[model samples]
Target chain A: MDSLTSPVKSAHPEGTAYGTVLDADVALRFSTLDAEYEAIRERAALLDLSGERIIEITGDAASAFAQRVLARDVEYLTAERCMTSLVLAEDGTAVDQVVVWGRETGLLLESSVGGGTRLLEHLKANADAGVEITDRTAEFALFGLEGPYAWGVVGRLIDGELAALPFESVVDTQWDGVDIVFARTGVTGEYGYKVLVPAESAEQLWTKAMEQAVPAGQEAVELAMLEVRQPVMRHEAGEGVDVLEMGAGWLVDITKEEFIGRDAVMAAFEAAAERRTVGFSGGDTVPAAGTPVTVDGEQIGEVVHAVHSIGLGSALGLLRLPPDLAAAGLKLTVGDTEVTTLTSPYVTPKSWSTPII
Target chain B: MTLEDLRAAAALRQQTCAQIKKMIVSRLDLPIEPAWITDDQPLFGRGLELDSLDVLELYVAIEAEFGVALYDSDMSVFGSVSRLADHVNPALAPSA
Candidate 1:
């Protein structure tokens, strides 16, 4: 793998490849900017996202009603695929982040941490009275494989051709002869898939994905196989951010006949969006997470996540900036350290963190 | 003043059993029960997991129902149905 521009490599490459430990036996690692996995933005790569929580919404009114409540158009999604969306409270604050999938009689909703309980409660209150809501977070394990080669590699794991499957497509099929529910959706900027397998069969599915991608003309998709905690970034960046500032305003459907947070989010959108979530340069010193962002001596927002990007020379951060100052080349202060603002997603898609083989 | 006078005085400032319990069930989203709740059970104990947020919501419901503003010290006064009943009785009573 090679690149014209790449972030500085971590001193301890091996330690960098593997992230902090989740458990004694399960070590996590993240790919660096020069690794082949980063190429996912352009071509393909794989990611493992087993830690994300999944919630299920079933019964008749699940689809139409959820479509009305969520930020994306859920009615248009079919069983074979998925879409990204946010669920906001009436105040426009992000109460829970969710992904909705249409699978047969119901929809599968993968929620953020603590969101499972909230989503379940929300459905119980808002969904049709007869709708059956279940928190299946305990029943299944989830894994993600992303990148351009994501489809090609994942297809090899299942019994049939996977690339032929439509985006957001889901099928109950055998992977290495194990029953699994494979959905074509992902969080990374590339085409990806999320596989839901019984907890008992998780090991088998994971082992199979690790072994199959290379043979399928795709490399193994190591999700956080390294120590890059992206969620931590989002969380640190999330405080100053309301939906409108996160570029997730699409989640707010003001025109919906009626839904939670519709008025609040729309009101916030109209009311100058006090702050905007933007990417910032770490410059010479990386601001600690939650460090306030300032411009011209006035406080704007704060840093959510700051990591030394091996792809970019300086520190890369997800920050919330006041709407007026979130443009490219805008200067801001991260703590006592002064910094410059860059375009959204300060890092390159796909190739930003990983190398293009 | 006599004990009856004390009870009367407390009653004048307290909330009704129906209003308090209704607010609890509605805020907690628990099944409605007309049975009277004695305020002795711990709000954070076994039967409920009322966190700081739940307690705050309960306060909002209490204020709305009884039309009384609760002070910070009043937060400790609510626990079991009995304590809640004792605390709200004076507020629910008709103003002299």
Candidate 2:
């Protein structure tokens, strides 16, 4: 197969930086990160997320196959409904976080960036009696419209009632003479939607969406993710931690009979999680990743993700700390700076009365 | 139920609504004042725009604060502050 390219890559002008997503080169930014970040928070911003992978699984046993590989229950999912789940290793460590969409034909699994290959292999390894898996990443281009005005832009383009759309639901519709899939999903914690269109029509869709939205890049998306306390896959997963410790136990359905790492997860829960992922603010200096967190000069945890948030106007950091030390208002030291622990999601949406996107 | 009991229950329901509103604002770190959150305002989607994750956090907070065990399937209780008060008020009543 030929190397993949994002349909909207050519639209980004000078000063645009490129980065590898999955195996494709994608535009990281068109303008300054600050400008893009502002667009996504206050107004509408369009992002080309085509670098994320989409895989299709079909056949009689597709749902059963998915149920085994993912941590969430898949038996109840119906057409146009999406469930966010974690693909786990045998030990219950997260391999990737994926959004699985139930379609009429079968199931569509959308992987987080850099997660496609491993997730595909995991699915194939656990394939049931009669299931077929295909890589559909190259066939489709994904774009996201986020921020307070996201729905308005999508409403203007689509004929349907955007207000009726529920969160985590998908709608198959036509836009500008092209077929598209609109999923009411977002990473920014604002009103948001994800648009999936054919690679051939992606440029046209991008052009139309851009008319109403300021073009944003990955860095801005990351800022939004942090403000909302959405965990980064690479930073949240790995040694010394499990999904339950990351405060994502809600994603795991204990009622489900089985899944890839169900046993390990249950055992971890039984053992009781010793540490948890929490957010912190009010630090004069932003701490680097892996910076030690201490209480009274006693080391307790390390910073997993840190950023200077323009939205909050403070340096924010996600830390893995013991439950005793993670309470809101608890003061801890990061390097020489004293920081106060706050709950996850430093930013909250101001209003839900209006259709956000 | 007796008229006196009914009156007491109504007062408890009102108190529950006030408490729930206060807990939501403080626990979720919402910027809105607790007094400003009307009883009938929707808590999810258009009214307050709280997402599923927010629902989970709110559930944990309510359970901790009020000792009311809300099931995941009982999301209708979250339709509005008034509805949540109705669901929780009876539970708060002292056992006969």
Global Cα RMSD, each model: 21.2, 10.5
iRMSD, all candidates: 27.5, 16.8
The residue-by-residue lDDT of candidate 1 on A1-357, one tens digit each, is 111110112211244343321211112334344454444444544444433456677767777678656755577677766766667665666656677776877788886433455555666676675567776755776666666566666656664476546556788877766788877665443556777888777665666666544211112122221111123213431544566565455334444555666677656655755665555665767678778876556666788666655446677766765444443344467888767544323332342233222
- Model 2 agreement with the true structure over A1-357: per-residue lDDT tens digits: 343567677766667887865555667787888889888887788888876779999999888888888888888888878877788888888878888888999889988766677777887877888899999987898988887777777788775475348888888888898988878887776778888899888877788877888888877787787776566676667685788677555456656788989999878877745876767886657888899987566788899878888877888878887654444435677888888665334666432334433
| lDDT tens digits by residue: candidate 1, B61-83 | 87887666665644335534434
TM-score of each: 0.61, 0.79
Write candidate 2's Cα lDDT for B1-96 as tens digits.
332443354455446767988999898998655744544444765346588899888879978987878875555567567567655666532231
True contacts kept of each: 0.00, 0.00
Instruction: For candidate 2, give the lDDT of residue A240.
Output: 55
For candidate 2, list the clashing residue pairs, or say none.
A151-A357, A352-B46, A353-B46
How far off is residue A281 in model 1, in Å? 1.6
Distance from true location, Cα of A144 in model 1, Å: 0.9
